[model samples]
Target: MSRRVVRQSKFRHVFGQAAKADQTYEDIRVSKVTWDSSFCAVNPKFLAIIVEAGGGGAFIVLPLIKTGRVDKNYPLVTGHTAPVLDIDWCPHNDNVIASASDDTTVMVWQIPDYTPVRNITEPVITLEGHSKRVGILSWHPTARNVLLSAGGDNVIIIWNVGTGEVLLSLDEMHPDVIHSVCWNSNGSLLATTCKDKTLRIIDPRKSQVVAERARPHEGARPLRAVFTADGKLLSTGFSRMILLRRLKELALASPPGDAESLGVVCCDCMPTAQGNNFEEPVALQEMDTSNGVLLPFYDPDSSIVYLCGKGDSSIRYFEITDEPPFVHYLNTFSSKEPQRGMGFMPKRGLDVSKCEIARFYKLHERKCEPIVMTVPRKSDLFQDDLYPDTPGPEPALEADEWIAGQDAEPVLISLKDGYVPPKHRELRVTKRNILDVRPPSSGPRRSQSASDAPLSQQHTLETLLEEMKALRERVQAQEERITALENMLCELVDGTD
Candidate 1:
């Protein structure tokens, strides 16, 4: 007879508490886009959410400190001609953010430290390479100004935002639409899941698939994948089981169960050192039968993985360990309303004094609420175990260095003294001027060069000119309206006199 041993984890007793009514952001009209995006993005300084705009795409950015009812006419970050699908904050710069829209373009904006009095209608630079709606955006984990965008065209374009140029375009990797894309700890490799029912580990610099597994899940539903702290792949899909694959071997390891189960399955890849071959996935856990897609957010500092379903009312988190039960269920944060989308705060953004292990901005139909997960502590001093040295705002590598095959871990910062967000840093784009290029000194070549500008470049220039003209006209109309209102007020004052 053997006794069953129970696993112990500090996060086992962690409980989630919603912020006070005054602390939560409210009265915001969340976007109604049915796209499979989080629709919200956050950093230590600001909270951004895709919102409903009349004629075009727009998202609202709010100062994290200034929480309460948002004014109906609050300024927005608007420039996309179509509905914005996804938004991601740059890990290295708190003031910088990237947005993807259905207009087949990506725009990066630099938000100011103080709230703006008017809408930020212009982007620092516009990247127009995707031929279809761009739905997913992810910034390089360790590189500054290196952003990745996946579009409906089934192409992934990694851009150097600082120079307004495409660094790498992985156009031929996935045969179908890419459902999800994640960077490893060092940003050297990418873990992506595509609609083709396959999971791939791609080395974007080499433009090659290092390892891949076909049909990790048999269901046709969307799949999501993220790299763990140990560099293993953890993927979840509608096939009612999560499949974990070892990157070295591309073998699947999942919990023992019927792969035909009718629910979302969560699996963690077991690390292995062996030959490259496909192995059956072993499932670690079976989730609820809800149709909502589970979005897994991994915290490398804490070794904790939070699973947030799109339309679910609760957030379930797990602790990944090296023991038998590789993934341990911690607890679920339940609420009354299902979250339409969620914004996860970086570990550095959490309040270390409050013993906050994780923080989430849960999006509702008409409001955005803050949910804090804390581990109770007996002492008031800083808990070293709970708060480890986490990735800070400073980047470890530049865009060019990363593109040139250099990899470095994120620079870590201690939370002992708490973290202070740096002052606003503007992202500058150094676009190449077409006129700067000198044509061949030879006669025939010089004449040909005058009319040989790339069609795409010409189209982009024309688009920018049209947008500037429209904006000028809009400003002029507003000025006239203001003058008319001032005259009317003056007349009323004279009549009263």
Candidate 2:
């Protein structure tokens, strides 16, 4: 028997334009994943929309603003010999962009500090490896210059943008065409949903997937998959065992429970496969999918993964937890206007001061609308209550290092403060100078930017006291860790003697 559900989501939608006018395109490919940006890379100054270029063999970048139409003088990146399938903005550099093409090549292009032209003829780097059309591309969440791409040949490759090299290629895992591939929070493990109806969790360093769940979904549909904030587990505390395992156990990783029972959902829309006696899939009544890829994006800091479908006009999000029914259904955000595509702004680009944790730019027939999701708070005041704790540590691999064959430190969320938006002046991407790859000096905590935030709030005694208290606690915690390590060392020494 399937269980019926009624969920009330906390998210509220507010639609506004990312540009000044209603931006329109000719047969915009919102039906497929295009990887266009809703906001600019450097300063959030412009919104990027992908359009079918000229006839059909290429894609053009349409830049818009809240003030005017696309600047004709602004250069359009045009190099693909075949139709461009998707594009991704570099997470670390606002000046950099990447596009995947049906010509079986991926091109990396750099935007000048100032350029005036309708199109650019060359790319900074061209990564050509796929035997068939390259269709998907994604940048690493934390690391710079690393990229992942999947193609029609049923293969995936991790690329190094700094040197333009193929760092790793995964070809033998999926029996059929690849549907979607996702990098967990820190880029340690990659989860792939494939036409074979299997979900594979990979240890990137080994070049082989150590675990997999067959037919995690019952429907014969292209689905999306992701690792929750905690590795492998879709939600925190979703299962008691998942929460209790040690970090090392998660590395070579023993799964917390039977893959069928813990990972697959027993949904009414999903039917059990031909010969498996797994636990029943969860009943997810909100999803209305007839076809196309259902891509999922997980925000580790917020513990939310939004699932968006290409054919469907609705987006359903779920909250991950440590507690079965580990993936709790949050409400679905629907619209009468179906989207051709969608773009999610990064955490740094969000307006957390207003308790805004997430922003999605949905492409309609005529305009790109910004949908803001926030936690409800009574005070207009900075709600530390709603934000994520401080960001976890950086990846162990440095820039230019190949992600393949190295064990990555799991991406974690350490609590201290939450998503604080970039300042308005800083956000004036159009009016600002390009940022250097690395600031001359950076620290654990950047003294907040000289934003328009009130000086009274900056100099408040309570603020100072709070800062000191947090610093002291961090120091004391470090000392305790050291003491424990020293004792372990001493015990080892005595045993040796």
Candidate 3:
């Protein structure tokens, strides 16, 4: 018998550490619709993934420079008492991360610098209002300290993390649970998808639904949506499979403009897949038999929308233009290992000089691998073939510069020298001792005698007992685990008869 070889992707350099190492996340487990974003968006520098950690919630933040099991220096954000369903990296500050859990609370955490054991046991601030599990969180794209969270209570709460206050709460906005929320480029408007099978665009200033699109899909499947760079809404849901329940095509439901332009077109398989049985006819690497959800990440700087599917091993890219049909199919990158989750690095975080345009981190049963998407240039020289007349990223407003009652023009990255390659970070694994994260405290410092700070400086009995208790519990757990493994081995040996 012969095995078929997986074809190499011409446009992508998929890289990761070998799975033989103890790199797979030991605490995470496979989950469902989760509504939790697989990747947190502090792109280009850091990526965070939420996992089912024991009876509570925890997230692992990965540095873009390393792959395989995360290094000891990376911060593992934890503290919730239930599974973390969603996480969002603060757009205004890279060090800040916000997480939501089934525990009905949202926490804001600040990541510490490279230290072997930087565990976040307490959050800087906690927002508690929802009576149900908080499954969604989205950071304000243009403003600082602003966050949006939705829960099963069918409410949208805007939190000001700087003051630990709830700026606005549409306590009874939707009739059903909110599935997703998205901010427009300028941050003046927000769009939400709900279990009631509707998409509503809300003007936060007025706290009213300025426009809405009902029944986006013909069938009743869970829906996810995001705003395009030009302010149009793109949503994903399942198709009308009366029998098997197939996935739906990426749909651009509303017109590409302000709330006033939405009354024209209601969504479906969009222009590319229109009149073609409503199935997304992409060049997919794998045909998934199970129903999957398409999570989209859009890059305003490049005008590319990357669609990552749940329970599948492929990523499909499409281009959005100003012309009719708006969406253009690019290509699909596929692999043999199925991804339980995935994250994308932003353009500013990419190594543009090396002809690199995009990067994706894929999580498997045991490991997280990076897939680098490029435009395929021959040499490191400036080639227009790989460099389309691409526009730089346009910030609706600067981090510290947002004016009330004003919308600013978009900003751009330097088109001439924006993507010079050598400085871009290449993802690779660095081999070091597991204990290499910290240096011995041997720097210039005054030494103190044991009697100088007797009771205050020394470890107290209470502290020692607490540490011993923790160690004892850990040893007991390990012993039980070893016994279970031995019994399993014996069962396998006896079965050989």
Number of the top-ranking candidate, with TM-score as the measure: 1
Q: Rate the local accuracy (lDDT) of all candidates.
A: 0.83, 0.57, 0.64
lDDT of 3 by residue, 1-497 (tens): 99996533333332222233333333333344346367434454466777546657787776544544444344567799887888886654566678898899999877653432446676778889888999888877666577899998988888777666677898767999888899887687888989888878888767888778777655575778888776777777766664664645677654334443322222332333322121222111122335666787887766777888877778877776554445656777877877777767656566557667777767776456667776655577764444444323333553234424455443444434564322222111122333335446656546566334444433564588679969977976796688689989999999996
As a TM-score, model 3 comes out at 0.69
Ranking by TM-score: 1, 3, 2
Better of 1 and 2 by TM-score: 1
TM-score of each: 0.84, 0.65, 0.69
* lDDT by residue (tens digit), candidate 1, 344-393: 99998999888998899999999999999999988889999998899998
- In the order shown, the candidates' Cα RMSDs to the true structure are 6.8, 22.0, 14.1
What's the CA error at residue 461 for candidate 3, in Å? Answer: 30
Query: Model 2, range 24-135, lDDT digits (tens) per residue?
Result: 3223432233432221122233345555555434444543333233343344577887777777876555556788888899988765544423366567778889999887
What's model 1's overall lDDT? 0.83
lDDT for predicted candidate 2 compared with the true structure: 0.57
Residue-level lDDT for 494 in candidate 2 = 100
